[model samples]
Target: MKITEKTNEGLKREYGIVVPNEDIATKVAVKLEEIATKVSLPGFRPGKAPKDLIKKKYEEAVSSEVAEEEINKAVDQIIKEKSLKPAYRPDINVESYKFGTDLSFELSLEVIPEIEIKPFDNITLDKFVVEISDKEIDERIEFFANRQKEYKNSDSQGPVKTGDVVLIDFVGSTGGVEFKGGKGEDYDLEIGSNSFIPGFEDQLVGAKVGDIVDVNVDFPKEYHAKDLAGKPALFKVTVKAIREAVKVEINDEFAKKFGQESLESLKKMVRESISHDYEMSSKMALKKRLLDALSNEYDFEVPSKLKEMEFGAIWKQIEDAKAKGQLDEEDKDKSDEELKAEYQDIAERRVRLGILMAEIGEANQIKVEQKDLNKAIFEEASRYRGYEQQVIEQYTKNPRLIEGLKAPIFEEKVVDFIISKVKLNESKVSKEEALKKEEEANEPAKKKAAPKKKTKAKKEEE
Candidate 1:
C-alpha cells in the first residue's frame, strides 16, 4: 500500500492511493472462506465446499466488497497517520481497479482550518443592562387583564365600532357566483381586528344591527387561497347583535383565575416574567456584540468548502422566500446577483465565526453538562405543551435529534465562557433604549461615501 500527496492547498488536501493486487486477493479469499462456512451447496456440506467452487460462484461479489473495505481501511490509516480533520466526508474517485491489478484512487477533501485562540481579556464589549420597571409590570398586568375581559350585549342601539364584537350572517361571492367556504352563519367578528380580508373588517365598522349591508373587499395578491387571490368579492351580511367589551378588574378573584393567591402575588409574577425577558434580551445582544467583535479581531482563511455549504443553505432560504412572495423588505429592491453577493459575505462571516467560536471553546475545555442538556431537552419539550412527554420520547429515541438540541446548548455555553473572560462594560439603560439599540445593531449596513479630508490649504481657506 502507498499514498502520495496530489494536492496541498489552503485547508484542502488530495491524495493518490495504491493498494496491491495481492492484498485485495487475500481479503477476497478470507471473505469467501467466511461465506463458505455458512452457505450450503447442492453437493457439498456448508464448511466442506471446495475453495475453487466457492471462488467461482462468489468471486465477483466478494472481490467488490473486499475492494471497498480495503479502500476504507487505507483511507482511515492515511487520515490517522496524517492527523487530518476533514470538514466533510472525503470524496474518493476510483481511478482504476481490476481483478489482478493494483487498485488506484484519488481522495480529495477540505480539512478544518487551524484556528488560533485569541486572548479574550483584550476584547471589550458593551453589555446593555435593562431593569424591569413598575410601569412595565403594570402594563403586563393590564395585558393579562385584557385577555380576561368579558363582553355583553350593548345597551344602546347603535352602529358597531372598533373593539366591538359583532355577530352576523354572511354569504360571500365572486363574479355573482358563491364559492365553497364563502358563507358563514352567526359568525362573531371583532371590528378593527383585521382577522378577515384586508377591507372586510373596515367595511363592517359602521354597520348597525338589523342592517343588511353588502361589504366589498379584495383578497390580497398573496392570499393563501389560490382561487380567491387578487380577486374582489362582495359579502351580503346581516348584522344580528353588537357586544361591547368590559375590562376585568384586577382583584383577588382575578388573581385566583390565573392560579395566584393575590393581586400582589400576580404583580410579583409579572415583574419576574418581565425581568426574565429583559435579561434574556440583554444576553442575546451581548452575544451578538461579542461575535461581531471576535469576527473583526480575527482574519484567517476559512475553508472554501464550508463557506460554500453555508452559502448554499442561505441561498436556498432566499429562493424559498422569493417563491412564497415573502422576500424581506431590504432584499425586495435588490437584484438576484446583488442579494447573492451580499448574503455570500454573510455566509463567509458565519462560517468564520462558527470555526473561531468552536476553537475557543475547545481551547478553554468548555463543555455542556448532562444536566444542562437535560434542561434544554425539557425546555424544548415544554414548547409542545400537552405533548411534552411524547416530544421527550422522540428526542430520546433519536440520537440525531438529541444532537440538534445539543448544538445550541454547546454554542451558548461557549458564548457564556467567552463572556466570562471578556471585559463587559455594564451600563443600565431603559428597556426601550436597550431594545432600540439592538434593532439598530441588527439593521443591514448601508454604504456611505467617506467625506474628503481637508488639505492644509483648504483648512486655511476655510
Candidate 2:
C-alpha cells in the first residue's frame, strides 16, 4: 500500500492512495477459500473445489469487494494518522482499478474547524421570569369553563340561533350527486363555531325543529378536501333537535370533569401548566440571546460543506414557504439571491453555534444518557394523552427518531450547564413582556442586511 499527499488546505485535505495488486489478489483468494467451504458446486463436494475454478466463478465480485474494503481501510488509517475530524463523509474517487492491477483513488474531505472555547462568566443574559398570578389562573379556569359549556333542550319552540347546539341529519350533494364523507346522522354541531363548511352553519340559523331545509354552500377555494373545494354543494338537512348552551360553573364538579380532585387542584394544575410555558419561553429567549452573544464572540472559519448543507436545508424550507405564499414579511421584498446571502449568514451562525456548543459540551464531559432519552421520550408521549404507549413504542422502535431527539436534548443539557456557569440577570416580567423579549431576541437575524455576492457581510452589532 502507498499513500501520497495531494492537497493540504484550510479545513480541506486530499490524498492519493494506492494498493498493490498482490494485496488485492491475496484478499480475493482468501475470500474465495472461505466461500469454497460453504458454497456447493456442480459435481464437487463442499470445500473441495479447485482455487482456479473458485476464482473463475467469483473473482470479479470478490475483487470489487476487496478493493472497496482496502480503500475504506486506507481512508480510516489516513484519518487516524492525521487526527482529522471530518465534517462530512470523505469523497472517494477511484481513478484506476482492475482484478490484477494496482488500485488508486483520490480522497478529499473537509475537516471541522478547531474552535477555542471562551469563558462565559463575563456574559450577562436577561432571564425573564413571569409570575403566574391567581387572577391569571382564574382567567384560564374561566376559559376552560367556557369551552366546557353544556347544552340543554331549548325551552322556547323557536328557530335555531347562534350559540345553540343542534342535532341534524344531512346528505350533501354536488350536481345532484352525493359525495363521499358528505353524509351524517344525528351529528351535534354548534352554530357559529365555524367547525363546518363556511356559510353552512349560518344557513341553519333560522331552521326550526322538525324542519327539513335545503341549505346551499360553496366550499372555499383553499379547503382541505380538494374535491369539494371551490365547488357548490346543496345539503338536504333534517333538524333533529335544538339545545341552547349554558356555561358550566367553575366548581368541584367542573374540576371532576377534567379528572382533578377539586377546584383548587385544577387551579394548581393550570398555574403549573402556565408556569411551565413561561419558563420554557424564558429559557428559549435566553438561549437565543446567549447564542447571539456567542456568535458575536467567536469568529472562526466554518466548514464550507457544513455551511452548504445547512443552507440547503434552510433554502428548501424557504422555497416551500414561498410556494405556499407564506414567506415572512421581511423576506417578501428581497430577491432570491439577497435572501440567500442573508440566510447564508444565518446558516453560518447556526453552524458556528452548534460547533461551539458541541465543543463546550465535550470540554465539560456533558453527555446524553439512556435516562435522559427515556424522560424526553416519555414527555413527548404524554403530549398525545391516551396514545402515550403507542407514541413511546413508535419512538422506541425507530432509531432515526431517537437520533433526532438526542441532539435537542444534548443542546438543552448544554444550555443548562452554560446557564449555571454564566451570570443570569434575572428579571421578573409580565407574560406579555417576556413574550416580547423572546421576539426581540430574534430581531437581530431578521434585521441583518446581507451583502451581495463576493462581498463581505457587515457584522451585526450586539
Candidate 3:
C-alpha cells in the first residue's frame, strides 16, 4: 500500500492512494477462507470446498468487499498519518483497478481551518432590559378579552356600518361575462377587514336583507387573478343578512369562559403570559444583536467546504423564493455579479456565526442537557395541546429534528455564557424601543436601483 500527495492548496487537498494487488488478494483469500467454514457448493460438502474452487467461484464477491475495505483503510491511514481533518466527507474517484493489479483512487478533500477563538472577556455585548408595566398588562388583558367577543344581529339596520360583518351572495361580470372566484353564496365578510376588493364591501352599505343591488368596481392591477385585474365589473349582490360583533364584557363571567375561574385569575394569567413573552423577545433580540456584533468583530476565512455547503443551502432557498416570485425587490435590482457578491457575503456570515457559536459553546462547556432538552421537547409538544406524547415521540425518534432543536439551545447557552463573561451595559428600554432596534438591525440598507438587464436573468440566478 502507498499514498502520495498529489496537490496541496489552501485547505484543499488531493491525494493518490494505491493498494497493491497482493494486499487485496490476501484480504480476499482471508474472506474466502472464512466463508469456506460456513458454506458449501453444489458438488462439495460443507467446509470441504477446495480453496482454488472457492476462489474461482467467489472471487468477484470477495474482491468487491476487499476493495471497499482497502479503500476505506487506505484513506483512514492516509488521513491519520497526515493529521488532516476534513471539513467534509472526502470525494473518492477510482482511478484504475484490475483483478491482478493495484487498486488506485484519487481523493479530494477540504481540510478544516484552524480557528483561533478570541478571548470571551474581550467580547462586549449589551443586554436589553424591558420593564413590565401594569398598563401593558391591562392592554394585553383587553386584547385577550376581545378574542372572546361575540356577534349579534343588528335590529336598527338602516345602513351597514364599517365594523359589521355582512353576509351576502354576489356575482361579478365584465360586459356580461362572469369570472371565476367572483361569485359566492352566503359569504360572511367583515366590512373593515379588507378581505374583499377595496370597494366590494362598501357598496353593500344601506343594503337591507334580500335587497338586490348592482355594485360596480375595478379590480386592482395587482390582483392575483390576472383575467379580472384592472377590469371594471358589475357585481349583482344580494344581501342575505346584516350582523355586528358583540364585544364581550371584561367581567368575571367573561373571564370564566376563557377557562379561568374568575376575572382576577384571568388578569393574572394575562399579565404573566405577557411578561414572559416580552422577556423572551428581549433576550432573543439582544442575542441577535450580539451575534451581529460578533460577526462584525471577527473576520476569518471559513473553510471552503463549509462555505459551499452553506451556500448550497442558501442558494436552494433563493431558488425556492424565485420560483414563487418572492425574490427580494432590492436583490432583484442588482446585477448578477452584485447579487452573487451579496449572497456570498450572507453565506460567509452564516458560516462565521456557526463556527463562533460552536467554539463559544465548546470553550464554556455549554451543552444541551437531558433535562433542558426534555423541557424543550415537552414545551414544543405542548403546542399541540392534547397530543404531547405523540409530538415528543416524533421529536425523539428524528435525530435531525433533535439536532435542529439543539442548535437554538446551544446558541442560547453560548450567548448566555458570553453575556456573563462580557461587560454587559444593561440599558432599560421600553418593549417598543427594543423591537425598533431589532427591526433596524434586520433591515437591509437601501441601495440604488439595478440597471435593466439585456435579457431576463435565469430563474435560479435571479
Each candidate: what lDDT? 0.81, 0.84, 0.76
Cα lDDT tens digits for candidate 3, 111-164:
766677777677666667777787887788788776666666666444677777
- Give the higher-TM-score candidate: 2 or 3: 2
Candidate 1 has a TM-score of 0.87
Poorly placed runs, candidate 1 (over 4 Å)? 169-188, 212-238, 443-462
Cα displacement (Å) at residue 175, model 2: 4.1
TM-score of 3: 0.80
User: For residues 283-367, could you state the per-residue lDDT of candidate 2 as single tens digits?
Assistant: 7667767776787789898889888987777777777777877777767898999988878987787787788888899999999
Top lDDT hit:
2
Error of 1 at 6 (Å): 2.3
Cα deviation at 233, candidate 2, in Å, is 2.2
What's the lDDT for candidate 1? 0.81
Residue 144 of model 1: what lDDT?
88
TM-score of each: 0.87, 0.88, 0.80
